[model samples]
Target: MYPIIRMVKQMILHRNDPPLSAMGTHVSHHRCWPWDIDLWMELNNGRTLTLLDLGRIPLAHRIGLISVMRQKRWSMTMAGVSVRYRRRIRTFEKFEMRSRAVYWDDRFIYLEQTMWKQDGECANHALYRSAITDRDGIVPPAQVIEAMGADNTRLQAPEWVQGWIDAEAKRPWPPMQD
Candidate 1:
Protein backbone atom coordinates (compact mmCIF):
# COMPACT_ATOMS: atom_id res chain seq x y z
CA MET A 1 0.00 0.00 0.00
CA TYR A 2 2.82 2.38 0.83
CA PRO A 3 4.50 1.54 -2.44
CA ILE A 4 1.33 2.20 -4.37
CA ILE A 5 0.89 5.51 -2.63
CA ARG A 6 4.48 6.41 -3.45
CA MET A 7 3.98 5.49 -7.08
CA VAL A 8 0.85 7.62 -7.20
CA LYS A 9 2.76 10.50 -5.65
CA GLN A 10 5.51 10.16 -8.23
CA MET A 11 3.05 10.06 -11.10
CA ILE A 12 1.41 13.21 -9.79
CA LEU A 13 4.77 14.88 -9.35
CA HIS A 14 6.03 14.21 -12.87
CA ARG A 15 2.73 14.88 -14.63
CA ASN A 16 3.71 12.07 -17.00
CA ASP A 17 1.62 11.50 -20.09
CA PRO A 18 -0.10 8.18 -20.70
CA PRO A 19 1.62 5.64 -22.98
CA LEU A 20 0.06 3.77 -25.89
CA SER A 21 0.73 1.21 -28.59
CA ALA A 22 1.68 1.96 -32.21
CA MET A 23 -1.93 1.26 -33.17
CA GLY A 24 -3.13 3.68 -30.44
CA THR A 25 -4.35 1.07 -27.98
CA HIS A 26 -3.56 1.66 -24.36
CA VAL A 27 -1.30 -0.85 -22.64
CA SER A 28 -0.89 -1.49 -18.93
CA HIS A 29 2.31 -0.96 -16.97
CA HIS A 30 3.86 -2.62 -13.92
CA ARG A 31 3.62 0.32 -11.57
CA CYS A 32 0.01 1.06 -12.39
CA TRP A 33 -1.20 -2.52 -12.98
CA PRO A 34 -1.90 -2.86 -9.29
CA TRP A 35 -4.54 -0.22 -9.83
CA ASP A 36 -6.38 -2.55 -12.22
CA ILE A 37 -9.18 -5.05 -11.59
CA ASP A 38 -7.19 -8.14 -10.57
CA LEU A 39 -5.23 -6.39 -7.90
CA TRP A 40 -8.26 -4.40 -6.85
CA MET A 41 -9.98 -7.69 -6.02
CA GLU A 42 -7.14 -8.71 -3.74
CA LEU A 43 -7.16 -5.39 -1.93
CA ASN A 44 -10.89 -4.88 -1.72
CA ASN A 45 -14.23 -6.65 -1.88
CA GLY A 46 -15.03 -5.22 -5.34
CA ARG A 47 -18.01 -3.23 -4.11
CA THR A 48 -17.38 0.03 -2.29
CA LEU A 49 -13.63 0.20 -2.73
CA THR A 50 -14.00 -0.17 -6.47
CA LEU A 51 -15.92 3.08 -6.52
CA LEU A 52 -13.31 4.64 -4.27
CA ASP A 53 -10.50 3.54 -6.58
CA LEU A 54 -12.28 5.01 -9.56
CA GLY A 55 -12.39 8.32 -7.77
CA ARG A 56 -8.87 8.17 -6.38
CA ILE A 57 -7.02 9.36 -9.45
CA PRO A 58 -9.07 12.47 -9.94
CA LEU A 59 -9.13 13.18 -6.24
CA ALA A 60 -5.36 12.92 -6.12
CA HIS A 61 -5.09 15.28 -9.06
CA ARG A 62 -7.43 17.74 -7.37
CA ILE A 63 -5.38 17.62 -4.22
CA GLY A 64 -2.19 18.16 -6.20
CA LEU A 65 -3.68 21.08 -8.05
CA ILE A 66 -4.85 22.75 -4.87
CA SER A 67 -1.43 22.25 -3.37
CA VAL A 68 0.30 23.72 -6.40
CA MET A 69 -1.98 26.74 -6.52
CA ARG A 70 -1.67 27.22 -2.76
CA GLN A 71 -5.37 27.26 -2.23
CA LYS A 72 -7.29 25.43 0.48
CA ARG A 73 -10.99 25.88 -0.25
CA TRP A 74 -11.45 23.80 -3.36
CA SER A 75 -13.32 20.47 -3.06
CA MET A 76 -14.13 17.65 -5.47
CA THR A 77 -16.21 14.55 -6.07
CA MET A 78 -16.45 11.44 -8.28
CA ALA A 79 -19.90 12.55 -9.50
CA GLY A 80 -19.88 10.55 -12.74
CA VAL A 81 -17.74 8.24 -14.91
CA SER A 82 -17.64 5.97 -17.95
CA VAL A 83 -14.86 3.39 -18.32
CA ARG A 84 -14.36 0.95 -21.22
CA TYR A 85 -11.95 -1.95 -21.21
CA ARG A 86 -10.36 -2.75 -24.58
CA ARG A 87 -8.34 -5.70 -23.24
CA ARG A 88 -7.29 -7.42 -20.06
CA ILE A 89 -4.29 -5.79 -18.46
CA ARG A 90 -1.79 -8.22 -16.97
CA THR A 91 0.61 -7.45 -14.15
CA PHE A 92 3.87 -7.41 -16.11
CA GLU A 93 2.81 -5.02 -18.87
CA LYS A 94 4.25 -1.52 -18.79
CA PHE A 95 1.72 1.31 -18.96
CA GLU A 96 1.23 4.95 -18.05
CA MET A 97 -1.67 7.05 -16.79
CA ARG A 98 -2.17 10.79 -16.76
CA SER A 99 -4.72 13.10 -15.18
CA ARG A 100 -5.33 16.82 -15.56
CA ALA A 101 -7.47 19.35 -13.78
CA VAL A 102 -10.29 20.39 -16.06
CA TYR A 103 -11.81 23.36 -14.29
CA TRP A 104 -13.21 24.93 -11.13
CA ASP A 105 -15.60 27.64 -10.11
CA ASP A 106 -17.34 28.51 -6.88
CA ARG A 107 -19.15 25.21 -6.76
CA PHE A 108 -17.12 22.22 -7.96
CA ILE A 109 -13.90 20.84 -9.44
CA TYR A 110 -13.66 18.78 -12.62
CA LEU A 111 -10.92 16.44 -13.81
CA GLU A 112 -10.02 14.15 -16.71
CA GLN A 113 -8.04 10.91 -16.62
CA THR A 114 -6.43 8.57 -19.15
CA MET A 115 -4.37 5.39 -19.13
CA TRP A 116 -2.26 4.16 -22.00
CA LYS A 117 0.05 1.41 -23.12
CA GLN A 118 3.76 1.76 -23.81
CA ASP A 119 3.09 2.29 -27.48
CA GLY A 120 0.85 5.28 -26.75
CA GLU A 121 -2.61 3.78 -27.22
CA CYS A 122 -5.53 4.87 -25.12
CA ALA A 123 -6.84 2.27 -22.70
CA ASN A 124 -9.26 4.11 -20.48
CA HIS A 125 -10.51 7.65 -20.02
CA ALA A 126 -12.92 9.28 -17.62
CA LEU A 127 -14.31 12.66 -16.64
CA TYR A 128 -15.30 13.29 -13.04
CA ARG A 129 -16.79 16.10 -10.95
CA SER A 130 -17.22 16.72 -7.26
CA ALA A 131 -18.99 19.44 -5.36
CA ILE A 132 -16.83 21.93 -3.57
CA THR A 133 -17.40 21.83 0.15
CA ASP A 134 -15.75 22.70 3.39
CA ARG A 135 -13.55 20.20 5.18
CA ASP A 136 -16.54 19.01 7.14
CA GLY A 137 -18.64 18.78 4.01
CA ILE A 138 -20.94 21.57 5.04
CA VAL A 139 -20.75 25.12 3.72
CA PRO A 140 -18.33 26.24 1.06
CA PRO A 141 -15.11 27.40 2.61
CA ALA A 142 -14.22 31.08 2.74
CA GLN A 143 -10.86 30.47 1.16
CA VAL A 144 -12.51 29.02 -1.91
CA ILE A 145 -14.84 31.99 -2.04
CA GLU A 146 -11.87 34.31 -1.92
CA ALA A 147 -10.06 32.31 -4.55
CA MET A 148 -13.01 32.73 -6.86
CA GLY A 149 -13.25 36.45 -6.23
CA ALA A 150 -14.11 38.70 -9.17
CA ASP A 151 -10.60 40.03 -9.64
CA ASN A 152 -8.88 36.61 -9.41
CA THR A 153 -7.52 34.96 -12.53
CA ARG A 154 -9.26 31.81 -13.67
CA LEU A 155 -7.17 28.67 -13.51
CA GLN A 156 -6.34 26.96 -16.78
CA ALA A 157 -7.64 23.44 -17.18
CA PRO A 158 -7.30 20.73 -19.80
CA GLU A 159 -9.80 20.42 -22.62
CA TRP A 160 -11.45 17.21 -21.47
CA VAL A 161 -12.06 18.55 -17.99
CA GLN A 162 -13.47 21.93 -18.92
CA GLY A 163 -16.97 20.86 -19.89
CA TRP A 164 -17.45 18.71 -16.83
CA ILE A 165 -16.68 21.53 -14.44
CA ASP A 166 -18.88 23.89 -16.34
CA ALA A 167 -21.76 21.43 -16.20
CA GLU A 168 -21.21 20.67 -12.54
CA ALA A 169 -21.22 24.32 -11.62
CA LYS A 170 -24.60 24.80 -13.24
CA ARG A 171 -26.09 21.75 -11.58
CA PRO A 172 -27.71 22.47 -8.26
CA TRP A 173 -26.84 20.71 -5.05
CA PRO A 174 -30.04 19.71 -3.33
CA PRO A 175 -29.00 20.28 0.24
CA MET A 176 -27.11 23.49 -0.28
CA GLN A 177 -29.55 24.97 -2.73
CA ASP A 178 -32.44 24.42 -0.35
Candidate 2:
Protein backbone atom coordinates (compact mmCIF):
# COMPACT_ATOMS: atom_id res chain seq x y z
CA MET A 1 0.00 0.00 0.00
CA TYR A 2 1.16 3.52 -0.69
CA PRO A 3 2.01 5.65 2.33
CA ILE A 4 -0.68 8.26 1.72
CA ILE A 5 -0.94 9.39 5.32
CA ARG A 6 2.79 10.03 5.61
CA MET A 7 2.67 12.02 2.40
CA VAL A 8 -0.04 14.21 3.87
CA LYS A 9 2.01 14.70 6.98
CA GLN A 10 4.95 15.88 4.91
CA MET A 11 2.74 18.26 2.96
CA ILE A 12 1.34 19.77 6.11
CA LEU A 13 4.76 19.99 7.71
CA HIS A 14 6.18 22.04 4.85
CA ARG A 15 3.05 23.91 3.88
CA ASN A 16 4.36 27.19 5.16
CA ASP A 17 7.84 26.90 3.68
CA PRO A 18 8.94 29.73 1.44
CA PRO A 19 8.97 29.11 -2.27
CA LEU A 20 12.29 28.07 -3.77
CA SER A 21 14.03 28.58 -7.07
CA ALA A 22 13.67 26.00 -9.82
CA MET A 23 16.89 24.19 -8.90
CA GLY A 24 16.66 24.54 -5.13
CA THR A 25 16.76 21.50 -2.89
CA HIS A 26 14.02 20.29 -0.53
CA VAL A 27 14.85 18.27 2.56
CA SER A 28 12.58 16.00 4.62
CA HIS A 29 13.09 13.49 7.40
CA HIS A 30 11.56 10.02 7.57
CA ARG A 31 11.74 6.77 9.50
CA CYS A 32 11.85 3.22 8.29
CA TRP A 33 8.69 1.77 9.81
CA PRO A 34 8.15 -1.92 10.45
CA TRP A 35 5.80 -2.05 7.48
CA ASP A 36 8.50 -0.52 5.31
CA ILE A 37 10.91 -3.38 5.89
CA ASP A 38 11.40 -6.57 3.96
CA LEU A 39 11.66 -10.19 5.14
CA TRP A 40 15.33 -9.63 5.91
CA MET A 41 14.34 -6.73 8.24
CA GLU A 42 15.82 -3.86 6.27
CA LEU A 43 14.11 -1.15 4.27
CA ASN A 44 12.70 -2.70 1.11
CA ASN A 45 14.24 -1.45 -2.10
CA GLY A 46 10.82 -0.64 -3.57
CA ARG A 47 9.72 1.13 -0.42
CA THR A 48 12.71 3.41 -0.66
CA LEU A 49 11.41 4.69 -4.00
CA THR A 50 7.93 5.20 -2.60
CA LEU A 51 9.33 7.10 0.36
CA LEU A 52 11.14 9.38 -2.09
CA ASP A 53 7.73 10.75 -3.01
CA LEU A 54 7.42 12.21 0.48
CA GLY A 55 10.24 14.52 -0.45
CA ARG A 56 9.71 14.99 -4.21
CA ILE A 57 6.11 16.19 -4.04
CA PRO A 58 6.88 18.72 -1.35
CA LEU A 59 9.79 19.78 -3.54
CA ALA A 60 7.43 20.49 -6.44
CA HIS A 61 5.10 22.34 -4.08
CA ARG A 62 7.93 24.51 -2.74
CA ILE A 63 9.16 25.29 -6.24
CA GLY A 64 5.62 26.27 -7.38
CA LEU A 65 5.42 23.39 -9.87
CA ILE A 66 2.37 21.92 -8.19
CA SER A 67 0.45 25.15 -8.45
CA VAL A 68 1.37 25.49 -12.08
CA MET A 69 0.31 21.94 -12.80
CA ARG A 70 -2.97 22.46 -11.00
CA GLN A 71 -3.73 25.68 -12.85
CA LYS A 72 -2.90 24.13 -16.22
CA ARG A 73 -4.54 20.80 -15.55
CA TRP A 74 -1.25 19.05 -16.20
CA SER A 75 0.30 15.99 -14.57
CA MET A 76 3.82 15.00 -13.72
CA THR A 77 5.09 11.48 -14.26
CA MET A 78 8.35 9.63 -13.85
CA ALA A 79 9.77 8.35 -17.12
CA GLY A 80 12.87 6.65 -15.73
CA VAL A 81 15.16 6.42 -12.75
CA SER A 82 18.54 5.02 -11.65
CA VAL A 83 19.19 4.32 -7.99
CA ARG A 84 22.28 3.19 -6.11
CA TYR A 85 21.83 1.60 -2.69
CA ARG A 86 24.75 1.48 -0.31
CA ARG A 87 23.97 1.45 3.40
CA ARG A 88 21.19 -0.54 4.99
CA ILE A 89 18.37 1.08 6.97
CA ARG A 90 16.96 -0.96 9.81
CA THR A 91 13.41 -0.78 11.06
CA PHE A 92 12.67 2.27 13.21
CA GLU A 93 15.74 4.01 11.85
CA LYS A 94 15.43 7.64 10.86
CA PHE A 95 17.06 9.31 7.87
CA GLU A 96 16.94 12.52 5.90
CA MET A 97 15.92 12.74 2.22
CA ARG A 98 17.19 15.40 -0.11
CA SER A 99 15.62 16.12 -3.51
CA ARG A 100 16.49 18.70 -6.08
CA ALA A 101 16.09 19.45 -9.77
CA VAL A 102 19.48 19.21 -11.39
CA TYR A 103 18.33 20.55 -14.75
CA TRP A 104 15.94 20.02 -17.63
CA ASP A 105 16.10 19.56 -21.34
CA ASP A 106 13.64 20.01 -24.17
CA ARG A 107 11.66 17.01 -23.02
CA PHE A 108 12.29 16.01 -19.39
CA ILE A 109 13.32 17.36 -16.01
CA TYR A 110 16.24 15.62 -14.36
CA LEU A 111 16.22 15.32 -10.57
CA GLU A 112 18.76 14.01 -8.10
CA GLN A 113 17.82 12.64 -4.69
CA THR A 114 19.73 11.18 -1.79
CA MET A 115 18.96 9.35 1.45
CA TRP A 116 21.38 10.11 4.25
CA LYS A 117 21.84 8.05 7.39
CA GLN A 118 21.99 9.69 10.83
CA ASP A 119 25.74 9.18 10.73
CA GLY A 120 25.83 11.40 7.61
CA GLU A 121 26.66 8.57 5.26
CA CYS A 122 24.69 8.45 2.05
CA ALA A 123 22.51 5.38 2.25
CA ASN A 124 21.22 5.70 -1.30
CA HIS A 125 21.19 8.05 -4.26
CA ALA A 126 18.91 8.28 -7.30
CA LEU A 127 18.58 10.19 -10.49
CA TYR A 128 15.12 10.62 -11.95
CA ARG A 129 13.83 11.54 -15.37
CA SER A 130 10.41 13.13 -15.13
CA ALA A 131 7.97 14.57 -17.59
CA ILE A 132 5.01 16.89 -17.40
CA THR A 133 2.03 16.05 -19.54
CA ASP A 134 -1.24 17.50 -20.62
CA ARG A 135 -4.15 15.93 -22.48
CA ASP A 136 -2.17 15.85 -25.70
CA GLY A 137 1.22 14.54 -24.58
CA ILE A 138 4.45 15.44 -22.83
CA VAL A 139 4.96 19.12 -22.17
CA PRO A 140 8.37 20.63 -22.81
CA PRO A 141 10.38 21.74 -19.81
CA ALA A 142 10.70 25.24 -21.20
CA GLN A 143 6.93 25.50 -21.44
CA VAL A 144 6.46 24.16 -17.96
CA ILE A 145 8.94 26.61 -16.51
CA GLU A 146 7.28 29.51 -18.26
CA ALA A 147 3.94 28.45 -16.86
CA MET A 148 5.44 28.31 -13.38
CA GLY A 149 6.63 31.91 -13.82
CA ALA A 150 10.23 30.78 -13.61
CA ASP A 151 13.03 31.72 -15.93
CA ASN A 152 12.96 29.54 -19.02
CA THR A 153 16.63 29.78 -19.79
CA ARG A 154 18.31 26.43 -20.17
CA LEU A 155 20.75 25.26 -17.52
CA GLN A 156 23.56 22.92 -18.47
CA ALA A 157 23.36 19.57 -16.74
CA PRO A 158 26.39 18.27 -14.84
CA GLU A 159 28.75 16.03 -16.80
CA TRP A 160 27.67 12.88 -14.97
CA VAL A 161 24.00 13.61 -15.50
CA GLN A 162 24.55 14.33 -19.17
CA GLY A 163 26.45 11.07 -19.47
CA TRP A 164 23.49 9.20 -18.02
CA ILE A 165 21.18 10.97 -20.42
CA ASP A 166 23.38 10.02 -23.31
CA ALA A 167 23.48 6.42 -22.17
CA GLU A 168 19.73 6.15 -21.76
CA ALA A 169 19.24 7.25 -25.33
CA LYS A 170 20.90 4.04 -26.47
CA ARG A 171 18.69 1.78 -24.39
CA PRO A 172 16.07 -0.03 -26.45
CA TRP A 173 12.52 0.74 -25.39
CA PRO A 174 9.80 -1.95 -24.98
CA PRO A 175 12.74 -4.15 -24.16
CA MET A 176 13.13 -7.92 -23.81
CA GLN A 177 11.41 -9.37 -26.80
CA ASP A 178 11.55 -13.12 -27.15
The model with the greatest lDDT is 2
lDDT of 1 by residue, 59-159 (tens): 35334433423366545545565454554434546556555445555555444556566777865665655455556773332344345342234466665
Q: Candidate 2, 114: how far from true, in Å?
A: 0.5
Tens-digit lDDT track of model 2 for 51-106? 99998999999999999999999999999999999999999999999999998999
Q: What is the C-alpha RMSD of each candidate to the true structure, in Å?
A: 8.7, 0.7
Q: TM-score: which candidate is best?
A: 2
lDDT scores in order? 0.46, 0.96
Over 4 Å off in model 1, which ranges? 1-76, 135-178
Residue 138, model 2: Cα distance from true site in angstroms: 0.5
Q: Which residue runs does candidate 2 get wrong by more than 4 Å?
A: none
Candidate 1 lDDT score at position 37: 39
Task: List clash counts for every candidate, in order.
Answer: 18, 0
Pairs that clash in candidate 2: none
